[model samples]
Target: MKKLLTMFITFFKIGAFTFGGGYAMIPLIEAEVVDKQNWIDKEEFLDIIVISQSFPGALAVNSSVFIGYKIGGLIGAVLALMGVVLPSFFIILIVAHFFLQFRNNHIVDLLFKGISAAVPVLVLSGIDKLAKSLDKSVDNLIILIISIVAVTIFNIHPILIISFAAIYGILFLRKKVD
Candidate 1:
């Protein structure tokens, strides 16, 4: 009971304060769950991230549900999902109600600008953390370079990359293990 409440409160705070969407929430979630809460280790967190990204929904919501389920089963998943969603829900309602009135306000514009500026930094931090967790193998580096090329140069979709990577792991990496 206590654990569930704590998880809810933690997610609620994250959902309320994180200015950007799922990518921006990554660092904050990592801090709370991996660093502070000790709910999951870095490797598990990375796996959750990959799985969450593979899913079709919002990254933060999907990750939250997975983490909650891992920690506290079905009920935990519900509470965590609610905790993370409610803040955005309420804030969107408030914003939708008052946005017209504040549309022309310079302060509001500046506030948005500041938040937009910070979001990239948070995302970069998350990428850095995730990168540090990966094994320093040549194959990983080759994959990383190829992925960058595929996305930036060729403009390939991420889903395709993930699929290829999964297949490579299953076929090649599995053989190495066996």
Candidate 2:
């Protein structure tokens, strides 16, 4: 019961304070779940990030549910999800009510512009962290290059790229021992 409450409060704080999207929440999640609570190690956290991204939902919510389940089962998952979602839900409701009034305000425009500028930095920080953790093996490098090219030049969907990479890994990257 205590642990469930803690999870709810922690995720509520994260959801309430985080300005940008999932990428922006990574550092905060890491600090709380990995560093402060010691629920999972860094490698496990990285795995959670990867798994969260691979799925369809928002990364922050997915990760919170994952961690909550790991800590306290199905009820915990529900609690954590509720915790993270409630803040955004209420904020959006309040903002929606007043946003039209402020839509033409220059100060509000400037504030949004500043927030937009900062979002990329937060996203980049997440990319840097993920990059540092990636194994620099030749096959992995090839896959990375292919994924970049496919996304940037060919404008391919990321899901297709990830699927190809998974198939490639299974078919050609398998290890054999005598």
Candidate 3:
């Protein structure tokens, strides 16, 4: 019970203050879940992030639910998800009303522009952390390179890219006798 409450409160604070939306939520999650609470290890957190990205819905919300479930089951999942989203929902509703009226304000526009730029940087940092933990073998590098090239040049959908990588890994690198 106390653990669930802590999760809810901690995520509520993170979700309430974080700007720039889902990508920006990564750092907050890392600090709380990894550094503070030790609810999930870094590898598990990264896997959860990857899994969340491969699906639909908001990535941050999905991650919160996943971590919460891992910690304290269904009830915890509900608490964490509600903690993360509810404040943002209400704040958006209020801010959207004000924002329309102040749409032409230069300061507001510039603030948003700055935040939009930073969101990508934050997301990239999360990716960098994930990459550092991965085995940087030649085959893995090749798969990563192929995935990037296909996405950049051919605009392959992410699902197809992941599928191709999986198939390649299975066919070429099935566990062989050491």
Candidate 4:
């Protein structure tokens, strides 16, 4: 009961306040869950993030639900998900209700301008989290470099990039000379 309330409110706060979306929320989640509340350790948090990324669905919400469940079982997952998403859901509803009329407002414009500036920071944080989570190895490094170069320079379809990577690994990395 008490834990459920805590879960809802904490996620509610996260959903309500943070400026950026999933990536931005990562740092905030770390602060609240890892540093402040001690709900999860860094490794668990990272593992949850990884699992969330691998599966289909929203990353932050999925990770929060998993963490919440770990902490307080089924009820915890429900509460954490609510905490994480309720604010965004409501805000989107309210914003959608009036967004067209509000779009031209000077205050709203400035607010969006401010929010746009935060996106790069959010991306950096997301990258940092991924770096921390992934195993450090030459193969990983090479794959990262090739992916970046292919995406940035060639502007290839993502599917092609994934396919090539998969094929490269299967043909070369997986085979051993016996």
For this target, which candidate reaches the highest lDDT against the unseen true structure?
1
Q: Model 3 lDDT vs. the true structure? A: 0.86
Report how far residue 23 has shifted in candidate 2, in Å.
Answer: 1.7
Each candidate: RMSD: 0.9, 1.9, 2.3, 3.8
Error of 3 at 45 (Å): 1.3
Off by over 4 Å in 3: 169-178
lDDT of 4 by residue, 68-156 (tens): 89989998998899888889899999999999998889999998998899877986886787688777878878988998999999998
Model 1 error, position 32 (Å): 0.5
Q: Between 1 and 3, whose lDDT is larger?
A: 1
Candidate closest to the true structure, highest TM-score: 1
> Which portions of model 2 show Cα errors greater than 4 Å?
174-178
Q: Give each model a TM-score.
A: 0.97, 0.92, 0.87, 0.79
Q: Clashes in model 1: which pairs? A: none
Q: How would you encode candidate 3's per-residue C-alpha lDDT over 1-178 as one tens digit per residue?
A: 9999999998899789887777778888988999899999988988888777767788889999999999899999999999999889989899988988889999989988998888788878767777887777989899899899999999999889877776786788787413
Per-residue lDDT tens digits for candidate 1, residues 34-128, read 99999999999999998999889999999999999988999999999999999999999999999999999999999999999999998898889
Off by over 4 Å in 4: 129-134, 153-178
- Model 2 Cα RMSD, Å? 1.9
